[model samples]
Target: MPNTTQNAPTNVEEIATSMQDTVLGIWADFVNHSPFLVMGALILLFTWGISALAARLMDASLRHSKMRGSLRELFVRLLSIGIWITGILLAAMVTFPGLTPARALSAMGIVSIAVGFAFKDIFENFFAGILLLWRFPFEKGDFIECEGISGQVEHISVRQTLIRQTSGELVIAPNSFLFLNPTKVLTNLPRRRITIITGIAYGENVTEAVRVIEHAVDECRTVHKDRPLEIFPQAFGASSIDIEVTWWADPTPVDVRRSRGEVVTAIKGALDEAGIEIPFPYRTLTFKHPLETVSLEKSEGEIS
Candidate 1:
């Protein structure tokens, strides 16, 4: 510290000189190591190209296999993922010849664990969605009731299933829940039976009412003629005779519901046109207590 030389370079000048020497050293190393560097680069490039080409070919082949829609989509995604992962690993090995895949994977284990834990739910959903897509428990345009909601399936994707209800509401349900829970597919059968309950006056003939219902069912356009429709007397109520009419519909729930509405309206109109009396409950009130009887009398008087 006591020695002073004006000719000695300042700290800034010394740092600048050291930087220049470091740059020259790096350039020399690069020139000397060109072969290895070029070789690694070329290997990586070749691996990437091959992986991309293989993934495309596999996807095309799977699409042509005429497999189920869900299975085809899943196979394509899985094949592409596998190819890219393998290619990246190969590229990493080529970039660092001394580093093995085992070592690299081991080093990355902790980070992978942390990431997995952080996104565990997301991973669960993703895997469950893949399973659902592959297995295809349900398909597009199927009438399914799940998670306390009943609707026709509009679309299905990896994350959620879209459903449109008769009330004009769109429901988006998670694929994971659909995969885990029970799903009711109404459209699985070629046709579904529609049940309608109608009542007639107390004195009306039960047999005649059943005949009228049968005629109405046959006349309704929604009723499939291929399937025999059933109309019969079910029970004799206190004030009316209950008649049941059932018909088959080929469409999904929404269509069935619409057709059912039309059929019921037509049946009711036909019954009314035929002078069939549909009765409601007619009750005669008897007073249980004296005070209740007096209140009823007073209310009727006040209304008058």
Candidate 2:
């Protein structure tokens, strides 16, 4: 037996009818607001186009300026960000006619603290990057050593810097880390001084050794002739006395390496040609009573 009541709808039917009505209501609202929505979207698209055009124009206008390439890029990026932020606010207001400036300000104020906490590191890095671009000594293509990482700076962005190491590895370092740490810019000058230690036998003439080293290092192709070479007896060791050889070379890693090799080879060859001895570790042991001597004396006594 089945009981049916036409006046009462089942729960399932009621739920479906409610959903249908809700969807139709939403469709009607969308239709009524389609024009404003389209206008908002078009405004955003136009803003994007303008932002891009302005970036190009700014880059071209400042191409010949004295500002650094990274600084120029920063300016372009900031301009784009400003334009987009304005565009978004305009679009939102147009999309929602009821969202007034005062209401927007209230909403932003409510979330300001939370947003700041959430993006604290992001903002810190952004400001640090700006400082680095504005007045920091090192720039793109400059080799810098910060903390334990050292490499040539490839790019500087709002949040991080890309360093390309001599070994071909790329390191992404935060701008804050670079900003806070002590950075040594190896390429700050066109040339930098490099020192290497070499040793000679105790018997070698100190004056002759110094003279030979100076001549050899100076003859190297990469040695900066304008800068004076320094060769001095640095310290005395167990095996030999260490000679500190210092000269100026090009500040690039490859140039420094090549110059070092050349200097070392020249020193070794010069020392060897001059009949000077390079020191090596050696040990001389004198036993109080050698076994061979004792045995021989005992045999002689037995024979006697």
TM-scores, each model vs. reference = 0.71, 0.85
> Tens-digit lDDT track for model 1 on 1-304?
5444653557668999999999999999888767767777776677677767876787778777778777776776677667766766666676667879898787568777998899887777778878888888777778888868888888777777788886889998888888889888888788888888888998777777777778877887777899988887888777788888888987686668787898888778877888888998877678787653457888899999
Worst lDDT run of 10 residues, candidate 1, spans 1-10
Question: What's the C-alpha lDDT at position 81 in model 1?
Answer: 66
Candidate 2: regions farther than 4 A off: 1-7, 10-19, 109-112, 284-304
* lDDT comparing candidate 2 with the true structure: 0.90
Residue pairs in steric clash, candidate 2? none
Best by TM-score: 2
Clash totals for all candidate models: 0, 0
Cα lDDT for residue 101, candidate 2 = 81
Q: How would you encode candidate 2's per-residue C-alpha lDDT over 1-304 as one tens digit per residue?
A: 4555753468679999999999999999999999999999999999999999999999999998997787898899989999997887788889999998877667767786788889999888988998888775788999999998989999898889999999999999999999998899999999999999999999999899999888888889999999989999999877888999999999989889999999999999999999889978756678898555458888899999
Report, for every candidate in turn, its global Cα lDDT versus the true structure.
0.79, 0.90
Q: Which stretches of candidate 1 lie over 4 Å from their true place?
A: 1-66, 105-111, 148-154, 164-172, 226-228, 235-239, 287-304
